[model samples]
Structures are given as C-alpha cells and as structure tokens.
Target: MGQREIRACWFGAGVLVGAMAASLCAMRAMARARADVSADLSPEVSPEVSPAALPVEDAARAPSAAPESGADMFEYRGFVVHLFWQALAPARYKAWCDIWEAGAVVQEAGGPPATYPTAAEARMAGGAWARHWIQNNG
Candidate 1:
C-alpha cells in the first residue's frame, strides 16, 4: 500500500480502539453509579441487632412493618423458619431455617412449604419435617 493509505489505516484503527475504550469506561461508570444508588436505597441493618442475637420465638411472633409480599414466618421445634415466594419465580415457595442453631438450612428449591389449617397443626407438622430433614440431610 502507499504511505498515505497506510497512515489512513492506522488512524482508523486508533479511532476504533479509542471508541472501544470510551465505551468500556462509560459502562464501568454507569455500573458504579447504579451500585451507589442501590446502597443508598436499601435498609441498613444495625450492628447491635445481629440475626443470631434475636430470639427465634420473637422473630416468629413479631409483627413486621414491611408489607405482606407473600412471605411468612413460623416457629417449629424451637426453630424459626421463613417461607417466602421468590421474586423471579412467584409460583414457587422457598424455605429457610432462619435461626443459626437450626444450622441455617435452606430447603431444596422445588420443595413446597408445609401447609396447615392451624398454628398448632403447623407446629406439629414442622417438628416432623425438621426431624426428617435433619435425619436425612444433616
């Protein structure tokens, strides 16, 4: 190629590289701004009130100021379990043993939350479920 053509090719390559770099920088800045906004919006948990420090019974019985969004809490066999509907998959219910002493067990993703007509019946069923889970998985 002629000297002029070579120079034009190099200039084009440099411009392309510069554009790519500018795009990458812009994306990184946008990500950082999004993170900052999320941090500012989310509720901050107090250092004094760790989850382990809170009693399981109190957590189960306590009224949440937060709106009912398909999440439920239950006390079962001295442990508190939280059953909530996943945001992405609203049809499925996710269960978690909230208390540390319960080993913070997360139920299998597809497992359904135990259902009962009364709290007493729920407690009985929950105790059985806990025992079965511990024996098989723990």
Candidate 2:
C-alpha cells in the first residue's frame, strides 16, 4: 500500500486500541468501586470472636461453622437453603430449606435436601425455590 494508506491503517488501528484500553480501564474502575461499596455495606466481624470461645451448640448453629466439605448457603426473601454434605453419587452439594425469622431459623422444612454439583447451581435452584415458596406460602 502507499504511505498515505499505510498511515491511515495505522491511525485506525491506534484508535481501535485506544478505545479498547479506555473501555477496559473504565470497567476495572467500576468493579473496584462496586467492591468498595459492598465492603462498606457488610458488617465487619471482630477478630476477637474466635470459634473456640463460642459454645459447642452455638458454634454448630453458626453459619460460618459450616462443614469444610459443604458449600456456603444462599438466602432470599427471608428463606435460606443451607448447604450440606451429600455422600450420594453424582451430587457434590445438597441444600435444606429453612425459614429465617428475624435472622434466626423459625421453621425447617421436612424432606431430603436438594442436591447439585456446584454451589452456583445450588444457589440458582435455591433462588427458584425461594420464589416458589413466596408465591405459594407467603
């Protein structure tokens, strides 16, 4: 190509690269800001509150004391799907339904825990279950 055409191509490529870089920087800034806001909103736990200091019953009841084999539970609309260990084949994680009243369990559903392979999958199912429960039981 001629010098003028080569310059034009380079200018176009430079503009495209610049635009992409700008967009990426903007996305990162937005993500950082969102993380900061979330950190500010969440209550910070004091380091002094060690698990060993709590009673056995209280430790068992604590959400953070969930078994290492189990994933974290998901909550929605005052309902929670607690994660539990499942030895069953084809499922890695299981969830039990519980009603949360004023941040404490008010009711526990009778039935087997729902099983899923991943925590994210279980969370999605938990959200659906919460929605269904709200519609029918609310």
Candidate 3:
C-alpha cells in the first residue's frame, strides 16, 4: 500500500482504539453512578418514590454556558469543531480535530501526513479535514 494509505490505516486504527477506550470509560462511569445511587437508597426510602417527594434541591438544574471562541475552534453545521496540534519533531507537527454535538464527542479527524512546519498550518489542515468529513458524514 501507499504511504498515505498506510498512514490512514494506522490513523483509523487509532481512532477505533480510542473509541473503544472511551466506551469502556463510559461503562465504568455508569457502573459507578449506579452504585452511588444504590448506596444513597436507605432501607426506609422506597425505590419508587414520586418526584414530588424529592427535595427542592433534587430538581434538575439549568444547562451550562457555551464554549468560548478561538482561532482553532468553530461551530459548523450544528457541530462544535475543536482543532489541536502537537509538535512531533523540531520542525514537524501533527494535528487532529474533535467534533462535538450536545456536549459530547462525535468524531476525531486526523490530518494527513503532509509536512506542517507551524502549528497554525497543522491546525488548518486538521480543520479542513474535519469539515470535509462532516460534509459527507454529518
């Protein structure tokens, strides 16, 4: 296979691994949350208590503020795109982007292996790649 194809294959594998890790983390978190809720239940408290029985503080709260604006971040087609770059060598950089909707990650788009001498270039590449992905997949 070509170098570009090989890079894409590796990057795709990385994304899959990352997605699995995130799912495992979410599962563990859900289990912990369930345990916490169960521990909060006392022998006197019925498992099927009505909402009216809940204290005023138990009511759902308001949503948080929106994300701040920046050069490497922007909203596109109802999705929040965040761009980031890492220095891989003295004159080489790598970039990736995460797309979010409803405050959760939708996907990660990794930039091509093109030489990026500056962080700005890397971020631009990543953002472009992410936008294209969104156009076809979003």
Give the per-residue lDDT digits (tens) of candidate 3, residues 10-110: 87788689769756754664565456556756554544665366665542221112111113678999988877665556457677778888755789555
TM-score of 2: 0.33
- Per-model CA lDDT versus the true structure: 0.44, 0.50, 0.64
Clashes of each: 0, 0, 0
**Tens digits of per-residue lDDT for model 1, 19-117:** 596567546645654554445332433323444555774343333322212334565555455433322222222332332234333453223275444
TM-score of every candidate:
0.31, 0.33, 0.45
lDDT score of residue 59 within candidate 1: 44
> CA shift at 89, candidate 1, in angstroms?
39
Candidate 3: where are CA atoms >4 Å away? 1-71, 113-115
